[model samples]
Target: MTKRQSRWAKALALCLLASVASGCALPRSGPSKSEIYSGSVLEDGDAFVVSVNDRVTRATSVTPVLGFSSEFLNAGEVGSDTIRPGDTLGLTVWENVDDGLLSSAGQAATALEEVQVDGSGFIFVPYAGRIRAAGNTPERLRQIITEKLDAQTPDPQVIVTRLAGDGATVSVMGGIASQGVYPIERPTRRLSAMLAEAGGVTVTPEIAQITVMRGSHQSKVWFQDLFADPRLDIALRGGDRILVEEDTRSFSVLGATGSQNRIRFETQTLSAIEAIAQVGGLNSNLADPTGVFVFRNEPESIARAVLGRNDLVGDQRMVYVLDLTEPNGMFEARDFAIRDDDTLYVTQAPFVRWQKTLSAVTGSLTPFANYSQLAGN
Candidate 1:
């Protein structure tokens, strides 16, 4: 090669070497292990980078607790067939006398198919006057009418049939298959049955929440728990408002993993290992098994337990490290619980930085090599 060509190649190669040697400028998914730890409070950084262990696992393994209180669970169940105000009754009245009070001229019976019980709880009949039908079952209402008409019309018989009405109905809304008013019938008196009639929940059962609002009282329970634990299936009430919500709790996965996304909780609670698996595990080519990390804001109580000290107050920023290369690493990761909004990041292996540096060096030398080859010709 000519002197000028040789001098050009040497200058370019030196500049490339200098730039590659400065690994800090290399493209990476996130900060390296040392870089992340450099930001911790122990190193005058923003977070406490604690190594994963049995104590850390217990200190961080917290899942959301959701359920109904005693008042809600112990509330009495109303019979689905019970009568209530604003109900419409289908009544059939019969009389043995030739000239009946309610029957037409040649008819022994009269049909009152749509006898509505007024808001005041009374239904009106020609011979029976006004009688309280609310708070009484169809059979009880029939008996009440029979006694009232018996005094005027001899041997009077009465039949009352309950019909679908605004009374004793619940309004189901939110993330449900069918959103509307559902009657509290014999088949749907409790929360679970009513949810089924509403075409079930539209979201994942583990994260779906069922909320019931009755008058001044309200209660909530995990949708899956409703059937898992029968006690959560509280009775339905008239004018009750039920809401079914979608799975909203999620955690973000970043750094050297298969993909970076906010993953929704598949179950009520999840372990760090499970969460990592959900995001397609670590990036095999670049992930550093020795530098797995979890970033979260732990509550005061949890911070105290994790640090083994009571001096810390309020929520504290925590950065947890998981080294899968250790003997008990996998077990520790499996035991470490993942909470909502936690960040899972796997640092790129140190060799990855060196690889990036090598790649840069090779790329920068390609033109020099081509120039020298052409100059030799």
Candidate 2:
């Protein structure tokens, strides 16, 4: 070959080698490990965050409402206060009339295990056969027993007492120790006590996702409020079933984005622009300015009941395509909202993957070649 042609060929070879060895030529700074999808940017004026008292605006209309209610109370509304027929009572009643001494004679009178109250709320004893004990205080029962025994034994000593019934208990299932029934004493008013009884959530109970089911209705309480606010740690009731469920709702970002992987969106509303920022913004080179896609279920499903049918726009039900190439598009990207469980993927240029593979191969070859050359020397 001519000297000039040979020189050109050498230069080209060196450039090619450099491109493969360093990832600089791949367009994007680093090889992306994700696949991008298509989505849209919302109009700039449409996205905004509404404060609790902020006046409703076109932008604020899309924001979600945040508030507290009994259903949202962490401790949940006080369970039914009145005792029911099937309700189990963890009782501890004591009676020692006449200031009785602790002698062997009174030892037999001390009722121990399995001294259960029948369905009619009465327990029969040696002298006070079939005495009504349930619902009455230990003192009242003792007075009644004393009056009854007086007729037989001439001021006969009498005692009335009740202890926690082993059978009557509330079960704390899911995300807690002692996942079975816990004998309830007194009326349960605070939720934390029950949790403590059950060993306090298996692992924090995602406090925000906790649920309490009394009969049909279920209440949601955030753990933060339970401790931070006194109202959240409300008392519990008998037969109340508490469940510290996992927070199943979340979002994920993929492709040529700043942050990749899962991002939790616990609040009511999440927008596409917010999701992008959560993933650290798009990698400039790998991101296609013209073809950004937000993959989400039809907005009809997202805001169906949230916005109602009359409020939905024609584009609400369609997947939005956002062109982030222009400044206006940036504003629109900001407005395009994302929802829970939505996935945002920013795909690299199709050719980027091939370059990544080549770079890896070349990186491996250089190490092996250097090892061989040193050994040969």
Candidate 3:
């Protein structure tokens, strides 16, 4: 062969190999499993290559665990009948005799409306003087007013009604169906009921998060968990603030999956099988079942459990490997839980690179073959 043709063939092979082996520059979705391990901090490269097994699945099945604390759940229940300062009271005082102390010249009864309780927890009635109304119930206040008016008028009767007030209320904010202050009534004495009273959340229930802030204390729970586990509903308190927002937890999919995108968790607990299904599963033509990987920076405590060693400190970079071709491979994947911020990746089959090389070699050979024919002529 002439030197010109020889040089052209050699130059073509070198260019093809360089482009095919381009780590991040290639058109491939991402690096293969072996390429990912080379990025480990350890020299041996095993620090990032943990195999998924029963022990690993159970240890790394860490999901977002959210709920109200004991203090929030164990709070004393407040009865809706109880009155408080800032609450408006409506009273109707009836007397047997005409021209009574509270009544007009001809009327036997007098109606006192919009009588709001003072900040000091006291309310004033014409004949009853000042009475403490904050801690007393409406029924109890009726008895007190009746006794006071009885001394001035014969057979005096009283009826008390509590109006919608700022006394015992909750301020709901964020993506709720309605954002405003809702009164804590008999129908909305609990967290779930109060949320329902606000017309439910604006976000999907699967991704909804309910946060309750009472004074300096605050607690949160997933909207789905609140209904699944009744204990998370918790009791509502006066002057409490509630917020219904979408969950912030998410995971990303890369490599040879059906789709590559950052996906928000739609379920309370997401398994590997389910996460894979969320992205439309693996690409049948390019995926390598044996190279499924999950990359995450796990807390030191979890890293210890996964590696069965305590030497690692702080958060450890972990890459768990899953082999779906094994006998119980699918079962292990089903049990493994995908956590927030974790990256699920599937490498292309090993032979896929060779196919590219073959294509490049055959495609380039045509140009070289034509040059050889020209040289012969």
Candidate 4:
């Protein structure tokens, strides 16, 4: 070959090499194709595999770690409603066919008189002066008053009834149609009953995110679960507060998915398979069937169980891959629970990367080839 032709050949080879290297070094939009499909490329403390059989067990085990307080699991049975400090008591005294201070001539009973329980939990009757009334059942208070007045009148009988007590009420706030304080009228009033009394949940509020605040402690449960499981419908206590709000739990879809966006769960629990369906499934034309990945920051306890170690970095951040090409992958996805704020990614196929690289090289070399042909002429 001539000197000019040899130099041109060398220049063309250098240009081609540079073009290929630059294409390979280009910044990726998301996780690399190899990282998604190859297990060897995954780093230590990077990813974990959840098989079909272990999916249910692993999901159920980690669910409590996602902010479910055990205190709300079992509902305590409510006992008889007791009197509070500000409760008014309707007192009635009776004497058997006798005209006394508490009764009239031939009258069986005296007129019902109202007595309010004082701040010190004491109420005064005509003969039974200043008796402890707060925290006692109405029947128990009646017996105490009757015993105290027995000697004053012949066969003296007493009856006590609660007249009004705003202090014995619970507050239902947040996303309810009618938010207010409701009086606990019955001994067996429960959470569901109180929600109904407050005009039910609002239209915009998420039914799956209901919270109950009792003093300093708070617990959360789905409205559907509260209704489905009678045990979760705990009995209401005085000063208890209920809050209904929008669901904040969500997951994001990125890369080669049908729609790349964040999706909120409609129910308390959602499986990985359901999440895929929610975002319109994978992009079949560009996605690799074996490259479905769920990126999450798993709890350290769970990471220890799955990875058999606790020394992982960055809060056990892991990428869990699912191979839809395998028959069992769909079944495993159905059982794998998707937690809040997780990321679901579907990576492109390996061939797609090569095709893109070759296309860039061909485009770059076309100009060089035209220059060489024109110079030769």
lDDT string for model 4 (97-195, tens) is: 567867777887885666888888898787768899888988999889888888777778777888766547788888888998888777337888888
Please give the distance, in angstroms, between residue 59's alpha carbon in candidate 1 and its true position after superposition. Answer: 1.2
Off by over 4 Å in 4: 1-28, 35-61, 65-81, 91-115, 125-128, 139-160, 203-207, 308-315, 362-377
Cα error, residue 122 of model 3, in Å, equals 1.6
Report residue 273 deviation for candidate 1 (angstroms): 1.2
What is the C-alpha local distance difference test score of candidate 3? 0.86
Q: For candidate 4, give the lDDT of residue 294.
A: 80
Regions of model 2 farther than 4 Å from truth: 1-114, 186-188, 202-208, 252-254, 258-274, 277-281, 289-293, 298-337, 347-377
Q: Candidate 1, residues 332-354: lDDT per residue as tens digits?
A: 99999999899999999998888
lDDT of 2 by residue, 1-377 (tens): 45555565556557666765465555453323222211122333332111111121122235332223565354444323232333333322233443422224434233333466667777655555677766666567667766765654444554444454443456788777678787665544467777777777655433245677766766776655577677767666556778876555577776677877888764445556667776677787667655565545444434344333466654343334566676567766665666556666565765665667576656655655565556556
Model 2 accuracy (lDDT, Cα): 0.54
Clashing residue pairs in candidate 3 are none
Every model: Cα RMSD to truth: 2.8, 9.7, 2.9, 5.3
Pairs in steric clash, model 1: 39-45, 40-45
Worst 10 residues of 2 by lDDT: 48-57
Deviation of model 3 at 258, angstroms: 0.9
lDDT of each candidate versus the true structure: 0.88, 0.54, 0.86, 0.73
